[model samples]
Target: MSFKINFDSENVSTGEFQLVAEGKYEASIINAEAKEWQGQFSIGFDVEIRSDVEQKHQGAKVLYNTLYLSSTNPEYAENTEKKRNSFLVACGYSGKQSLDLDEVVKNIIGKSVLVYIKHVEDKNDKERKYPRVSFVAESKVNPPQPSGPPITVGSDDLPF
Candidate 1:
């Protein structure tokens, strides 16, 4: 099917992408997906910076982290596990209970965390830089509390 369409190219504008500032910011896990690369299993996280933190940025989204589930090297494997554990703990995983990676990842969606971002120069192109989530932890900021109507007592209700 073909139809006539009206379009204007002059009004369209493109802006250069900006990397999130290198600092700690409150962010939420917008997506969690299982991914495999070169026979290695991993989970990729897409984190969005809270808009309230900075007005100009308007909540920039970034590829936060990729946690590998398996690695052939012993040291790398141990480090990977530690990273996963740290992420789980930051998302409210208690060590007192049994752990499940799939469930933990699912439950962590929408969870708030303090992410420390750092800019790294691209290996191939030094002029190009990217934001990397160097570290993350439980957010110190508390969730908003509910407010209710003020309680009032009538004069008649009070007993002498």
Candidate 2:
């Protein structure tokens, strides 16, 4: 008889972190699919966490979410729109007009963004804290902003 932990501990995460910790992480949209539920269709996003945040998320691939359209259900118009708008905005959408599933997927999939995480506890007895996305911004490809006072020098300073 033997007892052993076979996996690499360094590759795993406990998923314990402070609430509302702002972190810049890269993510890849793994998949998009539509599902019908309660007589309505919703586009579900499967995103894969990437870069540094992967450790914080315990190597988790995605934070799952579903986008609902107002046209999907008249009774849930408000709720649907809210979900749809928030999801789109989080995916770096800035357009006023709503887009179809294919368009949304095209815009989000394979794209990375900066996100702020918030911890919220459930109403249940345990009240476990769950990390939720509070803010999202388009990933900056260029180098970081320059720091220090502005220089107003003549063109003669140039090497060219």
Candidate 3:
């Protein structure tokens, strides 16, 4: 007996090209890690879209976000800091306590979050597009509603 491999038909992907549309998705930080390039430091996240969403792209693994922690250029450094801060705030970090960067990266893994995905054209190949996780926040099952008594409106409050 002998076995043969079919190069053309045996190991090819048959799934169609799909993109997660621009919208918010319930997701989780499946993985996280510290990254560096050209002496610049950063945190990278791998997010997975939850299967409960209505879209067909659910359960897809997507690159969530990247936070650059170190940079040589002043302006770029400042922008990176702001972006990281915003991410921390969204994650419910008060910004008052001291944070260990490595610990923070590890803690974020497996955390449920709401991810905003957007598409942008590839710089080198303008015709091609990719989904980019633009923002992330703590997952809230339901948005908050206003409390207290409802006010009664009179005709006097009406304006033409």
The TM-score values for the models, in the order shown, are: 0.69, 0.46, 0.67
Model 3 lDDT-worst window of ten = 137-146
Q: Once model 2 is optimally superposed onto the true structure by TM-score, how far is the C-alpha of residue 40 displaced, in angstroms?
A: 1.3
lDDT of 3 at 143: 31
Clashes of each: 0, 0, 0
**Candidate 1 CA-lDDT value:** 0.76
* Candidate 1: stretches off by over 4 Å: 1-14, 53-58, 96-98, 144-160
Candidate 2's error at 70, in angstroms?
3.5
The lDDT values for all models are: 0.76, 0.59, 0.77
Q: Model 2, which residues run further than 4 Å from truth? A: 1-26, 52-55, 71-76, 114-160
Which candidate's TM-score is highest? Answer: 1
**Model 2, 1-160: lDDT tens per residue?**
9898779867977887544333554555667676677777777765555544434653355355555554644787876677667666757778677467667666676656554555556768456765555444555452234469887888898888
Error of 3 at 88 (Å): 2.0
Model 3: lDDT of residue 125: 100
Instruction: Give the Å shift of residue 157 in candidate 1.
Output: 41
- How many times do residue backbones clash in model 3? 0
